[model samples]
Target: MKPFVKWAGGKTRLLKEIEQRLPADFDEWENVAYVGPFVGGGAVLCHMLEHHNNITRVIINDINDVLIEAYRFIQDDPGPIISGLKEMESIYNALSNEEQKQMYYTSRKTFNDMDGIDCQKIILFLFLNQTCFNGLYRENTKGEFNVPHGKYKNHRILNESNLWEIHDALQTVDILQGNFETVGRRLLREHVFFYLDPPYRPIVEKGNMFTMYDRTGFNDSHQERLKEMCDYIDRRGWHFMLSNSDSRSSDGQSYFDNLYNGYIINRIEVTRFINTYNATQRRPKEVLITNYQPPQQ
Candidate 1:
């Protein structure tokens, strides 16, 4: 199953190593409840479903309402959504750059004014996501979508087949829109595994910062709150696995080391394509944290 959204902090690159780190008997454990407090791309969730059929129930939650609404739409009328997105993409391709900008801002304004999930709002969301720079779902202070138009003319706005596959995969899971802490409070204690991929702390002074979908950025306070929630889960005996930047630049301190001190942490070298212009900056290390100890070799 494909991810429901093109999230900024998705873990698509680290999926393989993360899978290998799991115990061989991980899937055989009965009554498994897979929980993702920050279900960005849903790549890990989809991987679990495809590989480990032992997951009895899955729960995913995100604070972004637009993302949640997209999932709901996928669950209901994926066909119409795909069709609408295709129409929008076609119209977008025919426009000049100035016209495209006009359409993007217009759709964003209409989306902000929309009260509910009417057809128009859904189309607007799809249109903006496809046209916006990097498929980013950014909003302004007043909660209006504000990302500018991207340069891509042949964007794959509607992936119908992938949407259908995701719809099928999500049929057995519960997807909700809420803060992670609120969802974590009601979780049961036994046979549960969590995968957390929060927005990574900035390596550079200004590059890695991301405005929240609703315009509220996840700052130091939010990170502290997440740490508190993770600690609570650790106390409850639930397994925890997390990934974050492993910056080794001279001027910066490692975020994972500073925040997750005294926890089981592993540093891995992962190559990521940092920019379309220069691929040299792509090779960077990332840190993975797990509550469970890996089996000895």
Candidate 2:
């Protein structure tokens, strides 16, 4: 049950670190809801559903309405999306290299112009992710999808079985499209475990932020607001784990350490798999901050 789309700041590579830090009592907990505030790519979401049976309820929310809508489309019925992707794949695979490039831009325009929920929007979202540059999602200030074609060869644009698996996995889950605070307010009374993966702050000052995830970019102020939410969640005795870029790369700064004071923050090494804009901007470290100490393994 892998994520249906390629997402920047995906947790696939960090899953091992995340799993190792789960509360030791997690498996013993009953009827706990698993909440994902920034459910991009949904790698961790799928992983939790696959491995943790204690997570009887799941709530996933994102700021991107289109992405959430895609999730709903798949959860409700993946048949049309599957059909659209198969047709798209058949046509895309037969085109020449030049033809593919032209088709990519044209399809991208159509995707950008599209509004509201429909099967085609979901189809184009998945298609652009597979064919887009670096399998990355970027947007202009206007929120249009702006990644160029990746010129990939023999890419499997449609993974039919995986879609079915995702559909089945998401059957009982609750999906929401809103800001993180909205999610926080709604979960105030739930017995839940939270995994918060916000957009990575720039590794260096004003240099390489990947916060274009939505038209409304996440900035220092938003980070502060999230920290406030974490404080509220922590005071309520809820368990949460958060991931973000280690800001001490070149400037020797401890921004997150100062923000999440008194918490257990582990600086873990990570390979830069996808270079979004520049090669030099790919930092090799990230931090996992947890409110409660993970039990010894």
Predicted model with the maximum TM-score: 2
lDDT of 1 by residue, 1-297 (tens): 667566665667778888987755687788788888778768898888888888888888887777777877787768878878888888877888788788788887788888877666777887777677877777688777777777776566777788899888888888889878866567665778888877665555445555365666676677778888778878888888887766433457666677777777887766654331122456566678887786543
**Model 1 spans > 4 angstroms off:** 96-98, 204-208, 247-253, 271-280, 295-297
Candidate 2: worst-modelled 10 consecutive residues by lDDT? 275-284
Winning model by lDDT = 2
* Candidate 2 wrongly placed segments (more than 4 Å): 188-190, 249-251, 276-283
In order, what lDDT does every prediction score? 0.74, 0.86
TM-score for candidate 1, please give it: 0.87
Per-residue CA lDDT of model 2 for 244-266, tens digit only, reads 88764346678898889899998
Write down the lDDT that model 1 would get. Answer: 0.74
